[model samples]
Target: MVRSDSAGNGGDAMKEHCGVLAIYSMENRPVAERIVKGLAALQHRGQESWGIAVPGEPILKGLGLIGQGADANAKKILSFTSNRGIGHVRYSTRGRTTLENAHPLDIRGEFAIAQNGTIANTEDLESVVEKEFPILGSTTDTKLAGYRLLQHYRAEHDWTRAFHKLSKELSGSYSFVMITHDGEVLAARDEAGYRPLCLGYDPDTDTHIVASESCALTALHADLVRDVQPGELVSLTKDGLKITKFAAASRHYHCPFEYTYFGHPSSKIDDHYVYNARRKLGRVLARKYPFKADVVIPVPDSARPAALGYSEESGIPMEEGLMKDRYRRKGSLRSFIEPTAKSREEIVREIITIKPVVDGKDVIVVDDSIVRGTSSRNIVQSLRDAGAKKVYMVVTFPPIRHPCYMGIDFPTREELLANKADGETLNVTDLNSKVAREIGVDGLGYNDINGLSEGIGLGKDEMCFACVTGEYLGLKKDPVLRTREEMKA
Candidate 1:
């Protein structure tokens, strides 16, 4: 569910690394402007920085929220014309946050690439790329992958073959969109479908669009086409959409967190509607956790659907006990992906606690997942200050014990709350008790992996539960299957 750069992963809260948007104007009309709209729709995936790459121009990139902040020229510069382009919104996991690392990473004039998901084994990839396609300034794995793409293309001459080679060379989750010097836009989903990437069409503009989520397509008034299949490479050009099954892992490992947390509620990932899946998660939580609370309060925005299902299933009235202070400067920020402790703190401050609803009541708070436990502690403290008689926590997803190496923000194993001081992951009951005590909650319940799979209508094997289960699937070319010791180290 997270979209953070596999490179800049350090913050406590889980982050969606990057959102990719690609638009190819069938009529060859200016699409640079539409790319901005699509990226804005996908901004939640990443907010630290954004950039767009189109042919015949240097990639336009900026640090911090797109078209805003100290980058005074962003708004105007993003308006530059191009009939087709690829755009990216980035949140780092393995690299520093700066314009130099902003994506749509490219080589001289051959191609540019923007991606969602982690290329966990970038160090090994360096031998294949670093010297020839050297990156400038601060580095992120994405910049390296960009050059690697070109390196493969150089040898293969055919992009489809190059992408297939890259698929074999790559060792983690990824969904990529790239633009060629000739304005060709191509999208490739990793072999396992580890991150979401889909296609859409806007009849009005006659544009072929690709984005991390279908929600971006909705923003462009585009019709949802099928998801770009796992191991599929789709090209959008004058010939329309050309799909090739460049590679396929033996099994698929779709990220479950998308349905639980990161994905836009209105979007569709594969065959499942994200909103419905979340509601099912809430219903499952209510059935299993069965809290006799006076009110069920959702951690704003992302958890709203799950909370609603919890309230409806439990017959406990759902109250808007907490709402984002939209008028506040940081109100729109998703706490988990804010990047900085200060920004994340501001997010906690932006929560408008409806004291009247929590006062003198036994309240059950529902949330997507607990990654670091910092936010949970602060949220519960706020409710206590609001006079909540008893506060219980119900989490939609299971406890996250291991760190995600696939484009998720929790790259360091020690940062996870479900682990011991020495970095040993805890069992469900022990983890629940420990997290509840640490967060000052009376009770806590986390969905187990099975419950989570059932709720999302997916079998355990169908999704990537590596962060929860410590079972990495489909990361190829000798995937770095870190042992507990190495993870802690």
Candidate 2:
């Protein structure tokens, strides 16, 4: 997610969003250790906290890396020996990063839920839930969802009916996985399809895996199945996979950012490969804004594919000019994790060490996106510090000029560099010039929105370009749907 306030090791340039995973095996085998491994693979989604919930065992959750906490306590989780479970890694787009805000949140110990995306009407819903239920343990939207589901189940002892009622009352992006006391795993995505969830099968163990990314299924050696259709629910039972549509929409607005930066490159969402899309984005950007540079260097891991595509298309030599330090504490581990304009500048100063590869050369620095401009600015400054003659910036995605209300953490327009002109989205060239001046770069170019959509091989109607275009699909026009400013008010 595009969190500007959170900081991390090299203060993370942006939030990693959240990851959700679940498994239901016909063999009735213990899945705690496997779930731990899957969570470790998905650590990039969110590092603030990790958690899991099985039918019979106590919920395992805590702050920090998943391997350190959940994996160490795998034995305790295995005592339940249930065949079905669900897990989540969170970065807190809605609530504070605390143990209470962790996912797989229990509902009176009857049902547990892990979800990605925000409920736009959280304040109103929270108020309603407070009157019917006990005071909530935490203020997270996901916890609220669990309680709301509880209210529905008690009124009508049917899970599907409860979910249908819940869907009607909530508005916004969500991909949810819920596990009941009966060992059934039910996964659903919101009508808009803003976040991702997919269903995969493991024939070897006769298991069905429902997760936020196909990469999680791949990590567990499961074959790729189609994505969980938007507004549809999939139930994994001993009787097999049951699919139903709880809500209906004429279109699906998949988050384009998923293909650009949010997803693991190995995962396929909606049949589009993320790595290929990024590489194609670079190719498109190079064609649109060709630069005369001696070499191209990536910002590191996430930008590597785009950098390679740029080098391939532009015929510039690609070099690894900066090194990423892998052993850094991420998420809400320290105060630095709460980023400010100053902290973002300091993070790039420490996290990436510059090599002499670009010395005496006009270098092109390729990054996936420029959220707040502080990290990009620091990167350009670092290159200058390393004796680079000139630095040009090539950003793959268009400028994020609007705060994402769906799920990404850039909740305020002021936090976005491109949205700084009294809430105006600047022209592409104007935005680039402004960012270039701030980052100390000789020149800057960004992929146009059309170019980005084309590179991802999807039409504008299929993806959520809300961050770039200042338009929110599937959102109701209401006062309760908040940006950071509204929330403060």
Which candidate leads the pack in TM-score?
Answer: 1
TM-score of each: 0.92, 0.91
Instruction: Name the best candidate (by lDDT).
Output: 1
lDDT digits (tens) for residues 1-489 of candidate 2: 001111111111112248899898888888877788788777767777888888766677878779888657756765757788889987764334666567767766677788888776666667778888745532567767767878888998877787789888887788888888777888998878889999899999998899899999989999888998888889888898899888877788888888877788898988899999989888898898798999999886678899999999999989999765555632122111233445344446555546579778899999888777777766787888788998999988888887777777777777777777332546788877877877788888988879988889888888888778776756754424355644543
Give one digit per residue, the lDDT tens place, for model 1 in 1-489: 102222431222122368999999988788877888888888889988888887777777778877573246555555566788889998875334766567776655677788898887877777767677444332456666766787888899888898888877778888889888776789999889889999999888889999999999998999998898899998987888788989977789999999988899999997799999988899999999998889999999889999999988999999899989988888988988866566777898889889999999999999998888878888999999999999999999888877888887776666677764222446677777888888899999999888888888978888988887676755665456455445434
Every candidate's lDDT: 0.81, 0.76
Could you tally the backbone clashes for each prediction? 16, 5
Clashes of 1: 16
- In model 2, the Cα lDDT at residue 411 comes to 73
List residue ranges in candidate 2 displaced over 4 A.
Answer: 1-17, 327-347, 421-425, 478-489
